[model samples]
Target: MLIAQITDLHVSFDPAFLDGRVAPLEAVLRAVAVLAALDPRPDAVLLTGDLAENGSAEEYAFIRHALGELDLPVFAVPGNHDSSPAMRTGLGSFMRASEASHACYVVDDFPLSLVGLDTSVAGKAHGALDPARLEWLEKVLGQRAGRPVFMFMHHPPFDTGIRTMDACGLLEGRERLAELIAWHGGVVGVVCGHVHRSIHTSVAGVPTVVAPSCAHQIALELRANAPLQYRLEPPAIALHRCEQGQMMVSHVRYIPDFPGPWRF
Candidate 1:
């Protein structure tokens, strides 16, 4: 099974895109097009978070229409900039079936099970999962025991060494989450999207990936007290392919047209 991952779109309704030359919505559309043109289409698309710049109704609507171009199944969760209510209302039928209160859900139609955890905190940049949400995850994992689960969330559970982004990383309940993942041998990996750069690490012996944004990316700074900044780095997406015996392979693909496919 193959899963295509896109994250941190930051789509906006601003005509000039916050008075800048690049329009984020256009980048999102390009990403969708790239996904659509893949050699072997992915079984599903995982939209990690930060779908909108301001989490406004109009922004959600724009995202809804833009993502609609891809007919494949799309699973999503809210990011720091997303409004829970607005996403619930705007995404509507696009979201997988789940309890109404939280956006956490499961997509089991494919070979690999997808479990999305809502890490977005309303009006806050950091992420946290209260007891109730953790309980929900435990219950889901228990019920789906022995299945290869790909857990998706907006905030990464580990620090990226980028001081500014790590400052707003998953705050509370991270240790509990790590424990849950450690206990669940079936969890193939934990996928996230807040840092806006492709990063890889292991959490509880399971692979944890932070996919790059389809829009701009956070500057890569590995220093204490580094300034918070963004750069117009090449946009990217992640593709995960499940191999024999449940070994998952991931590739970071940049969405740029380069001269290629020429014979050696």
Candidate 2:
């Protein structure tokens, strides 16, 4: 099965300047077109939060209509920029009824079990998984014992080299998550977004990845005090392919036009 991962949409109701003077909605539309044109379309799309520029109902409504054009089932988790209540109301049809309170749910229709976790803090730029949420996740994982599980959340549990971004990453409860992964033999990997750059790392010996933003990208700097900024780097999407007896494979496909492939 193949899944398309799109993140950090930052969609706004009004046109606003982003990287290279491009509007956020334009970037999202372009990315959606690319997803629509994939040769072998993905079975489902995973949206790893930041679905809105501001946690407003209008923004959520705009994004809901835009996503509806894809005509594919979308699974989502709330990011720092998302409002859990707004998402539940605006995108209610796509969300699981059982997860109405929070954005966490187990997608049951897919071949592999997908557990979406909510990591957004109420009024903070950073993320956190409270004891209640952590306990809930433990119960969910236990129920689906031995099934290949793909965990999705908004904030990456580990820090990337980007210092400013790292400061705003998941602040607590990661150690608990690592413990869960250490014993849960069925967890294939963890997929998340927030850093705005595609990053690969490991947590508790489990493969972890952060998808790139479809709108603008965070500047790549590794110094101790690098300025927080965005750049017009080629936006991209992550394609995760899972087979019967093989490890999940991830590919980063840049969204730019190139020369024709003349039977390479």
Candidate 3:
């Protein structure tokens, strides 16, 4: 199975976002176009998080309409810039009913179980997996005992060494989450967004990845106490492919109209 991951769209009704530096809406549309044109289209599209810039209904509505062009199942989780309630209501068609109050749910229709975890904290930049949320995840993982589960969420549990981003990273329940994944032993991979750059690591011995933003990217600054800033870099998406007996493999596909395909 193949899955396409897009993240940090930050779609806003306002065309001039970030002081007119980038157009989040257009950026997402471009990403969508690329996904639509893929030769062998992905089985599903995972909207990791930050689907909107203001968490507004209008923004979500626009995104819904924009994504309607693709004939693929789209799964989404909430990010810091998103309002869970607003997203749930606006993108109801794309999301399934969750037993937990948070926007956490499991998709069982695919070969790989797709688990979406909610890490967005309302009105806060940081993310956390509180006891209740952790409990819900544990229950879900327990139920899917032997299935190869692929988890996706907004914030990454591990530190990226980018001090500013790490300061607001998954601040709670990471250790427990790691333990749960280790205990399950069926989790194939964990995918995340919100760092606005492609990063990879292992959590509980499972490969974990953070997809780059579709609009703007966080500047690669690792200096201590560096200020948080964004750059209008070429947007990108992540493609994850998994086969029966092989581990998942990931590739980063940049979304830009650059020259390519010339004979090497």
lDDT of all predictions, in order shown? 0.85, 0.82, 0.88
Clashing residue pairs in candidate 1 (N, C-alpha, C atoms within 3 angstroms): none
Q: What ranges in model 2 sit over 4 Å off?
A: 17-20, 98-101, 257-264
For model 2, how does the per-residue alpha-carbon lDDT over 1-264 read when each residue is reduced to its tens digit?
Answer: 898998998887665444225467777887888999997989988889998878788877877787778888888888998888888788766566554345678887887888888998888989988887888889888888878888889999998989998899999899998888777777777899999898998887777999998877888889998789777677888999887766577888877742221211
- Could you tell me every candidate's TM-score relative to the true structure? 0.93, 0.92, 0.95
Per-residue lDDT tens digits for candidate 1, residues 165-218, read 988999978999988987777888788999999999988888889999887878
| Residue range 143-245, candidate 3, lDDT tens digits | 9998899999999999999999998899999999999999999888899999999999999998899999988889888999888887776789999987776
Residues forming the 10-long window of minimal summed lDDT in candidate 1: 255-264
Cα misplacement distance, residue 23 of candidate 3 (Å): 0.6
lDDT, residue 66, model 2: 77
Model 2 C-alpha RMSD vs. true structure (Å) is 4.6
Worst 10 residues of 3 by lDDT: 255-264
- Residue runs of model 3 more than 4 Å from their true location after superposition: 258-264
Residue 80's lDDT in candidate 1 = 96
Error of 1 at 239 (Å): 0.6
